[model samples]
Target chain A: MSERRTPDVLPGYEPLGAAVRTDDERWPTASPDGRRRLDGLRCHPSAPVWTHECGDLLTPEDHAALDAWTDGLATDPPAGDDGPPPAVLERLDRLLAVVPFYRRLGVDRWEQLPTISRADLARAVADFVPVDADLSRVVQGTSSGSTGSALVIPWHPLDIARDLPLLEHLLSRCGITWPRDPSRLGLLNVVHQEQAFTYASTMTWRDEQLMSRVNLHPSAWTDLDHRAAFLSEVNPQVVSGSALTLMDYVDLGLPVTPLAFVSGAVDLSPAARSYVESRSGTTVLDLYGLRETGPVAAAYGSREGHHLLPRTIHVEVVDDAGRSLADGSAGEIVVTSLENPYLPLLRYRTGDRGALTGAGRDRRIVGLEGRAAVRFVTGDGRTVQSVELTQRLQQHGVRAWAVRQRADGSVLARCLGGNHPALREAFDRLLQQPVEVEPVSGPVALGPGKPRRFASELGQ
Target chain B: MSDPLTDPLDHSVEGPDLQAMIGRLLAIPPDFLAGDVEAGPLVNDAVRLAGVRPAGDEAVRARGLGELALPERLALQVGAWMVAGPPLAPLLRTAPGEGRSYDGESVASALLSFAGLADAVPVARWTGEDPERHEEVVRALCRVLGLRPRGETHGVAEDRWVAVGSAARRAALRAAAEEQRKAEELARRLAEKRAQEAAAQYTHV
Candidate 1:
């Protein structure tokens, strides 16, 4: 799948709204003129996927080729020694100048601004948004939150488009490639806690075909025997889902010879990672990212954390003052997208925390802790994740559930179950908590639409 | 599915109507009904505020005021069931403080059970499964009940003979045949039931 780096020619292959089996073919080398073109895009604090230290191995020729390929892509911007894209900075400066909250804070650059917390955002919701800007132009998306609250994120299409290649690249690291025919790819789409109607297709090549079907609410991980039966029936070539969902598939003892298994949405633990690999034999790739920033870093085959996508976006691990933190030092991840302009975020603090590794532009990401920690004690005396409990809950008709840990260490689950009291008794004994069963009268409001597999005290 | 003799119409069953009855009962004014619906003010309040009349006035017209059809008060009950259909406002007529605790799903499930789609198995014994099997049983009983044709003139002399008639005998014959088919199907699989029973007896001994 190694294709020769080409100049402005690569940009010509801009994602045409479909996953193509190309991008693996050889192309021309990056020319100096093409590099200039890419640099022109970078005129405003923009960083293309090619300029980072992690991309240090990229030849000057490769950089030139990519620059020429993406000359006019609003998303393809040049990387700076540090900080956000110039355009992003300009927009932030403009926003700060006009927006009262920022004006009161006296912040010109986002770097000077204190990182906003979710609580703070909720409190200052009205003041934080631009008043004159038309929200209609922003593409609206919803996330079914773990806290049972729905969040609506308004962004431009370009910001959404940038996330595609990042996901494709992360999938590639785990050996997942584009389907032979993009038109026929069928994913067992998951919308929050419920599974959609299963569709059938004949695509079957483990690497070439992309017709693998998926199931929603990956909580079926508790019963390996049941999951194995399902996998044996569906027989997908590739499987990518939430970390909690993938863990459930592994727990189900299903045969795992998939080309790639991608994990996201929740933090994947080492024990959970090993369990999936051992069970499925598929390399598990952890994607460190968010809805706001797309994918930041993706795990390489070596499982040494995730490799930051060079130049696609600039990364910063900074102190509260927004000063760049040293490698291996923990700080909030701040990003400035060079490509997407619909909602230009300059130094947008990604609420997640992680560290940089390697040196210079070659730095990749190491660890990230986003969601809260939850453990499950297996019958084998092994402590797993609360994700397992949720997975098991899914196998029954329970489509939604939330596990709340009280101060006393007792976990209470508010769920939709036909046999509520019985399930409560059974789970109470299993989890060593006072399981209070409250039968929900209707379908649980699973938020706007994003599936949240794990809920914790963190980022509450 | 065609059994009619043991169906609701055949039996003089005394239970609430499948629709409108419960919702209407829930809508009765607390002071007017003497709070017979619930023990305390809260439950009574919940029921009164429920405001659930019948789905429409047509439903009342069709079902004769549903559960409110007392021996001498059928006319009043029938009048109350009919009303406007929308803004969905007229659908319920409860007091300010009283509202329904039962949501739509609970009401629908209850209705299904009343129609024999769901069985009356006690919660202690219920496994929450095999609703189709229970429905089949109900259907079979309904078919058995339909064996007797409408008697001539609705008179006892004719009705007695109709119950003992050749047509009734033929229906009984058909029922017996169907039952035997079911038993044979079981026998084909459980040929050693007697042996298993004998073994169980020995274990007890």
Candidate 2:
């Protein structure tokens, strides 16, 4: 465990490889202050947990100390600092100078780099991965995209380790203490609880917070009762999941109450949020971030827009042409991720559309719409996002669905799982008109990118 | 899961060479079929270009080139059932998509910002979620149709996909049993605690 010797290959830890490219050695190598922080790894005072495999992440004790140490160097700028911090800009400039992808793209300046789409990254992700990466440390995955179109961004091991603090800061902003109360569990409901995606561990990396990540995708549980029982049993003080997932769980009619529920991963519709909040009696905190960039923003309490996570990443709203847009103007959300030296993406085009309100720490993305929004129009001209409607159906346990407004202006709903009459009645009621529900063997019209939730051929 | 017995798309396309029949009927040119063979165009990209539409009869028409075999019809059914799999797997000739491994978390975070839930599903980059029931459903359809889809297609017909189906079922049974055992253990512990508390109260009295 000596500093001179390379760290052991921890369960999830990846050792840095020898320098390949001239600047490769520059990666994972840190400044004197940064190197001092790495000393926390040697101290193993955290309690032993049966399932925890990695002992490398900074402990909460280390977090408090390091946070205090880095406050002057790395704290957020004043509330009125309109642009990215000078330090962020300078580091990004240095990152651009080194990352192979940016270098190959000839991105001498941040603005010189072209904004990338999810489709663009999906196409060139392999090329974007750094050549000098320590292969063992690299882990890859696709985005949690309903359209099934998202980036497969690779991350350096250090970037993964660095995420620990960002998560803590984001959770703190949400008003919930992290390494949460030992008595109340921190339940994480993710997309898959399948065996392969099973993450059974205490928060050994931080404080040994009793945390569990369950797959909310239904298959993870034996039945709905099982899901409810699992939640009631865990009775997490902090329940974090996509807004839709939280809604579905709440709709299960469980008596479980948590201190707060953090919502992200999907559009948090007012209806869904209210449904959960009214029933569960907990605040819904919307965390705005992307995997390519770690958590960059989170709303405090029931705040309308998310406060920017400028500490971990810098966010800007720009028009389609990549021209930076003024505050309050809706445009594409562009992020300059401060993490991930393995495959640094500067000016990465997040396909979501939103507007930044306020400045510096107060900045928040408003009107943020991910995926091209298509609305299902009722005969009476009332329109709602089909994605929203589909989520509503999912709340009723219908998966794999699509709603289309035919050329003749007839609303048709198709699904593979449940053709529940109540679900149909709900859809019809939403449209304020009678609609046909067709039980099908396969999905309805699924166009590229996001699932074409609402398709209209009536020349809308 | 599309039932082999009920689908009107069920046709005469069959035999051990189910992949070939599907390839021929759909008039799937090599470029379109390139992804299925794990060759040609990048899988995710090629998969988007050609595939059966979800529209009922139109999808059937696109899937079945005029006349069809039971095996071919089953393949289409299998393809339809694979809406939950990689987008390209539905179009590629029963082969899995190769470029990326994104489970629910990665896509979920991007689809919506669940940064807390990010890396909740690991991105093994170049890996696709291979749920056993999907393979089991494929195997079940194949068995009922009595036409063996090609083995090396990589998309749907992996060499051990059928085995995966059985293994998944076994794992499911084991999981259910394990779940029951855990519940019993918990109940026993609770009961023991209750008894201990009662004895303690009696002793205090």
Best by TM-score: 2
* Model 2: fraction of the reference interface contacts it also forms: 0.00
Best lDDT goes to which candidate? 2
DockQ in order: 0.01, 0.01
In angstroms, the error of model 1 at A136 is: 3.9
TM (B chain), model 2: 0.23
Per-residue lDDT over A101-138 for candidate 1, one digit per residue giving the tens place of the 0 to 100 score: 34333345554554443323332332344434443323
What interface RMSD does every candidate have? 31.7, 22.9
* CAPRI tier for the interface of model 1: incorrect
lDDT for each residue of candidate 2 in A117-159, tens digit (9 for 90 to 100): 4544544453344444343334343354343332345544344
